[model samples]
Target: MKQHTLPALLALSLLVGCSSSEEIVPDVPPSELYSEAQVSLQSGNWLTAIEQLEALDSRYPFGAYSEQVQLDLIYAYYKNDDLALGLATIERFTRLNPTHEKIDWVLYMRGLTHMAQDRNFMHDLLNMDRNDRDPEPVKAAFKDFKRLLERYPNSPYAEDAEMRMFALKNRLAEYDLATADFYLRREAWIAAINRCQELQKTYPDTEAARKSLAIQLEAYQQLGLQEAIERTTELMVLNPI
Candidate 1:
């Protein structure tokens, strides 16, 4: 009886192990997998698209549609709001296919991904300003867009990249100006002046730069530094409000 019981237990354990760790692998060819992925993409089923694309990639790593699979996965990840994985995929694609014909597209996608993830998700409902949020993500997006422009100046995405970079610049300048204003309100004259100076110098063409100069003038007056006040007034004259 003991011998029979031990063999049955071993058989049951094997059965359980087989069921528990079974992978959901498709038996169809890579071509069919890619087709299913495309169907999912067209239907806006990003999670399904990601799954099929990943299946195709694993089954046929060097298949004809391998590159497209990677690209589509990045887009799918973005659409699914899986931004971290999207970024990781982007990094892998860039590192692996640095000289790919569609590298510009990849770079543009990377910049777009950065922008998408940086969006202030609660800002609309909370009536919050985007510029009031942390600036690191915006700065990252700006840098990525800049890289795309420098490396692929004539690419189809260059215009959009430029537009995004312009918006990011304004936001960054606004953040710096806000910091200066915070200091000025607290009567931290030197800190406020430094913030204003850095904002203007770093983002000279932004609208906030002009505002920062105004803040600088106020900080100077508060400190009663006559020479600094005169110099700041001259700057304001040149900026014309």
Candidate 2:
């Protein structure tokens, strides 16, 4: 009986050791994958690096590999000129992991992405022919910056985002003022006045503030309201220089 008990106990201990070894092994080797991907990225083989990182994410699904892959893919996408993909990935990561260790970096990247897409409409319009009037991309960029400001007010990116937001707001307000000027040239006083009012209420710090108030004052004069003109001129003076 003693001999039989000793053999059974030895087999049980061996089985326990096997289980522990199995537990120690990860589904995917994160360090190896990360190193290979980093090498590929450094060699300017962005697509290859992306594929390896994606493979790790798909096969492992959940592990240290997945986390690092998500983090590193941002650079791969950017260097590959996949700006939309890079921005989207960073945005999703920031949203899902607001308290993650790298949240500051994610927020900064988000702001950078938005700022990168910005183009002055006046500049573009002057460069292009009359056929292109689509302001959607500029508006979308503005929205992206606004998202960073609203979502990550305390982030390191917040101050930069605020500055960009202010710049974009002024640009948008200028766009409106330009439209109002065009309307004024067409003798559409009501339309011009409405656009000026929008600038006064929505974007008081931009160049639009001076132009919009001046336009509004002219509109008030043409429409015959001395009091309105005086009030608008005073507003123009008080607006930021």
Candidate 3:
């Protein structure tokens, strides 16, 4: 009998602990939730803003503020460093509202989000070469910026997008140069020359174009291609030093 009583007591203690540990967040009305989310955003409480915005969106999918909520969610997700969520939100918004007047802004934000994700704090702090890292996100941002410019040439965000695109183009060219250098080190002259030629064709005005031309010349010399070397030398001379 004493053993049975001890088991019952232990079960009751466990149940009490579980009940006390449960978190209880009060249910907020959609309007109140949105207001609270706005306050959180203004206060830089990204997590709280995300929570409230998500709740409002879930509760009032087609409410008066639905479109605005979606846009805000994208920005909030970006600020919270949830780049995947931010990009997903942007894609959904653009797909659903293709003709929305503020679509350019969405594209700009998408580009910014991609750029943020691509950023390497360690590389920046250590002055590491960006070309040595992954280029996918940089390429993604470049595409987004380019699309914005093509679709909305007169957009208020056009100038900034263009500037970012220029930088991204150069970065991409530098990546190709880096790869060419790697092939050159491995003595794969043909592969190195291909990469350099591709870089020159794709990013003619990039600073790396000169280096790529030089690499092509070196690869041609390494492979003992006299004709190719002469052609590359002429092209290199035509380009700025």
Candidate 4:
């Protein structure tokens, strides 16, 4: 019995050692790793690209391909739908290389990452109102895009960022108006009026501002504030419907 048990134990130990050896991936040189990552990226294998880039970054933090590796990692994360990782990577790159020649591209990618997170495909497909959802990501995306435009007005990405910002502003304004309408429906006339005024102040040129003025007029009438009603009505008239 002891003899049989000894052989079995030896066989089990050998099996374990073989399994560990199989699991160990051979480390590639930084250049080779970067080349592999680029190939993966070109082939649209985002997860594989991410793994190779991350390994390259970790193994050669200041190597020849370090900066390019970081930038590619951000793109890989974004393509993998890892928005948080993508944003964090962008922030790190900006913080580490403040004067990077391609800083504008980084900022543009950051804005794009935020915009990707802000979109809700299912809700959009259902034709549901974005105002009913959390607006934090939308607001963050808008701010990022605004900062990109402010800092890099001549960036090749500026036009696209501006278009996205326009849509986001309207969405944000609509969200505020939706809240004000909620207050109006609840007979919270003072709160409704305050929200409308705030919306008008923040998003003056938006269609939401026009709707907000209309809401304020209704709220003022409900609260019997004749002077306020008259002021809002006059402004709405000048704004043309």
Candidate 5:
């Protein structure tokens, strides 16, 4: 009986040693996680870096490391082609930590994100211009530029925003002219005259206003309204574009 017990004790000791050797390893250090995130970013693995940085947020929420992680998450979102998310995160940072040294940069990035989103629509409108089409996107682009101008008046983005506004104004004028042209081609004289009149009032400085005047003249003449024709002619001359 003593010999059997000795053999069982030895077997138990071996089992304990094996269990200790196979213990599950713990997670890496916070600093190591940060380093891995940086390396992943450098390697263009933006999504992986975002995951690592996000993990550090709850674990080290008040340290310089945490702040860095939050900042890096914005860049990671941008790099990962999530511009809307990036803009929102950065805007939160700006609102919550207004005194942060990078506030200007955050503002600039937000403006850029909005501009990028606007550009896709603007590009489609410009492409449509070749076929003389809808002006909805052109109107939308102006609204985008207007926001940038009003929100970040002193931002470095202001100059670009101003330029875009100028271009958009011209595009809007052209769209009005196109609408008038469409009405004329369809023999809708009253509609054509109305579009032309709107162009004169809304965009007084555009070549579109000039073309609108010509169309308005023809529409009023076709309707044989002598006084209305003369009135539209005067308005065209007073408001050229």
Candidate 6:
């Protein structure tokens, strides 16, 4: 439960500077403001798009393009790599418009945002493998994708969500494998074998599962358990990965 001092998380701790409630509302008309925002958005000017969109949201809170602006802002934040704001925008949109038609898309984007943040500043700072880092964000991303699939099975994002889930599953498996590898290195034979077995049972179709068999075989060999060694070797032969 160590808290990561990531760049995005640090930003989130500070106040949102451009919030409508705090900043003075611009005097531009809704159409003109929205038009400018659209131009910025179309031109790949994410910062400009955010500025214009924030202004539009502030000045004309109930404008015609309100919902579309919210959606566009989410994409803009994502493209800008502003993950914190993207998450914040998605949260607000879901809370305000829980039944919006694009809720599935929002959930998909939420998963993506979490996915993006999984490799945050800490990873780069320490050159740490993701398996050694905190797994919460990736876990959260997997859950978000799961929610999207379960609630919107017919959604266009369903296929992509499934793919993300598959990747996340392997990532989790790697985490489990890391634990088993640690126990093996420490010569905790029984614990290593138990972890490997649990990993194989949980992620039988994953590459990690196949790799776990090798670890289990090694653990059995280390402990001089001939029967377990033979069974694990057979499993490795059958898996062939």
> Highest TM-score: which candidate?
1
Error of 5 at 241 (Å): 8.5
Each prediction's TM-score versus the true structure: 0.86, 0.63, 0.85, 0.83, 0.54, 0.81
- Model 6 scores a C-alpha lDDT of 0.88
In candidate 1, stretches whose alpha carbon ends up further than 4 angstroms from where it belongs are: 1-25, 237-241
Candidate 3: pairs in clash: none
Clashing pairs in 4: none
Residue 82 displacement (Å), model 1: 1.3
Please give the CA lDDT of all the candidate structures: 0.87, 0.72, 0.88, 0.88, 0.74, 0.88
User: What's the lDDT for residue 26 in model 3?
Assistant: 38
Model 5 regions more than 4 Å off: 1-141, 230-241
Question: lDDT, candidate 2, residue 241?
Answer: 52
Q: Estimate the TM-score for candidate 3.
A: 0.85
Lowest-sum lDDT 10-residue window in model 4: 21-30
lDDT of 5 by residue, 9-41 (tens): 999999999987644322578988889889999
Q: What is the Å distance of residue 36 in model 2 from its true position?
A: 3.3
How do the residues 175-239 of candidate 2 rate in per-residue lDDT, one tens digit apiece? 78778888788888899898888867787666766767777778888999888888887887887
Candidate 2 Cα deviation (angstroms), residue 115:
3.5
lDDT of 6 by residue, 113-205 (tens): 998887757777997786856778889999999999999999999999999999999988998899999999999999999999899888889
Q: Which parts of model 2 are misplaced by more than 4 Å?
A: 1-30, 40-52, 91-98, 119-154, 221-227, 230-241
Clashes (candidate 4)? 0
